[model samples]
Target chain A: MRRPQFSALRERLLRAGVAPRAVRRTIAELEDHFDDVRRELEAGGLDPKDARSQAYARMGSEEAIVASTLARPELMSWARRWPAVAFALLPAPAFAASFVGSIAVIACLGHLAHSWLGVGLGRSPGLQLFSRCFALWILWALPTAAAAVCTYAAWRRRISLLWPAVGIVLVGVLGSLTNFGVQWGTATSRTAISAGIGISTGHLLPPLVRAASTVGLALLIYAGCWLASRRAEEAGSEG
Target chain B: MGDAKALLMSGVPELLILRLLAEREMYGYELARAVRAVTREAISLGEGVLYPALHSLELSGLLRARRRQVGGRTRVYYNVTAKGRRRLEYLTSHWRRIATAVEAALAGPQHA
Candidate 1:
């Protein structure tokens, strides 16, 4: 009977993962449509089996039906919500911390460089400019580069071990550079003042403090981003 | 005859099922045929719609299900609980109010 054909179609749709409620609703609508088509075929003197087959052909292919059902807005909306949330919250904090910390470490290094090199290079404009530029690149620019790389790696979920390792390396290198720059700048300026030459310790302190604060902030941001990335991975796995 | 019967049958089977179980219990195919006979073939419900609604109503705690062997086929019977009766009363009263308002509105405009 056509009943078995209808039942088998419904079971196939269900096994393909159509929601039960939607399956039932679609089947009912299809049955109603089939009934009208079947009656017309009967009036034309076609056998019941031929009428059923003709009706099935008119309704279109199984792939088309399944695709149309999945394309429904409500089903798509339900499927996309979790993945979108996981992506947004995952990498934000670590990126912030690394960026802030890199800036702070750079400032601290500038301060130390000014203190240490201020005297030896003061008489030579060419030497002083080169030393200042070199200090800034080593202390500030390098850490910024490292922090950026770490953040990108974490976000992409590639090489899980590399992200934390690179982050640790950046903090250590930048932190030392900052300390060295501050102490150097301070010692150089003190030597200049003691030699009866004018020098600015006031300027150096602010940059040093800023550098230290940046390091702290970057660490906070990095830890936060790392935690968030871990949580997103866990959520993705569970879902 | 067909149009009148169709209008009456559209939602009446659901209401009747609720009303019938307002007293006692019944199984799947039995309920289908009983509903058909009660409406004198005005409404013919398939097993498709009936079973799903029964399951949903059971899930919502308005009804409970039990299985029994009948005519060599396993049949699931449903009985209305206290919650079911309460929901039925709420639905019936609200429906009556809506129906009365609609009827009055349609009749008044036509008569005028």
Candidate 2:
């Protein structure tokens, strides 16, 4: 029995996504098989080429064989984890945390608005608190949505600036509507409006502050995630 | 000829390579040529597919490789080993049983 050649096989295994260590182990096993075939061929008075072909015929389809070898749970797990862990450790976790935190902040702002408007935080008239709360929630959603879309696009190696631009535009429109709504409410109400609270200047300032801060933070997180994604991509390529 | 060659080559390509090396050690390109020649050129194995299969078999402990200088080019020659022979025996025996079963089934009378 003659031994089968393996150097070329190792290269193939690498391209097939087999771990390097596994490739080495598989090579060792194959070497043993080759030795057995060599002995058999020699005993039968067959030339090396004839025996080698006979042995190879028994080994089965290369595609099926490689597929089975790579299908082992541990190897499959390793392959799956490579991309997932690489992406997770990048800006993904940080972005997720920031998004959740922004939602929490928006909830708190809703509470503050309820308290200040003397709407009793929950007993405000005609969906007033609800509308404002919903608006605040949307405000929070704008940047978070942008961040998500951008991060996903970046992960997939696509252009992602659309998210941030759309987010900025949404915020601008929502902010103006909020301001107008507040002004209309104050003007039509009998309640004594706080001079500096919902007045035109005050109304303008709050949304500006919220928009500026949210946009700034969103951009910062986005930039970080983008850089991280790029680094991971480079690392994957190098590997 | 194409169907016959395809059928012969379909399931046990590694065995074919091992059998080739069992006759004589050969490099990757030579092995591919041998397969083509034996099958009367009905089945052409691409390097992309052949190399990967070779690498896999090597990993499976069915083959061994050595570097040799051949006509001024460095060629990696492949050969089979002891364990590979045992596996080949097992696979061949298993295939024989499968072939018998398939033949019986095919030759059996069919109900309308």
Find the candidate with the highest lDDT and give its number. 2
Write model 2 residue lDDT over A1-239, tens digit each, in one string. Answer: 21236544544555566665666555554554454555566688988888877655544445544655564434322432453333333333444454456545545555456556644433456546655564555455544554445444332333345534454444433433332123212323332221111235546666676556655655666687668655644554454
lDDT on C-alpha atoms for all candidate structures: 0.53, 0.55
lDDT tens digits, residue span B3-112, model 1: 68646655554576777777779865456556667778655444335544555466568788887776574556789989889888887997799899989898776542
Cα lDDT tens digits for candidate 1, A113-217: 575455453455664565567556544554444444444433333223333444534443343334222222333353121111122565665445544544455
Predicted candidate 2 versus true structure: per-residue lDDT over B1-112, tens digit per residue = 9569657766567767877877888876667668878878665554324544566567677888887886675566888888878877887787899889889899997788
Model 1, TM vs. native:
0.35
Off by over 4 Å in 2: A1-239, B1-10, B42-44, B110-112
Error of 2 at A208 (Å): 35
TM-score, one value per model:
0.35, 0.35
> Candidate 1 chain A: worst 10 consecutive residues by lDDT?
A190-199
TM-score, candidate 1, first chain: 0.29
Name the lDDT of candidate 1. 0.53
How far off is residue A40 in model 1, in Å? 26
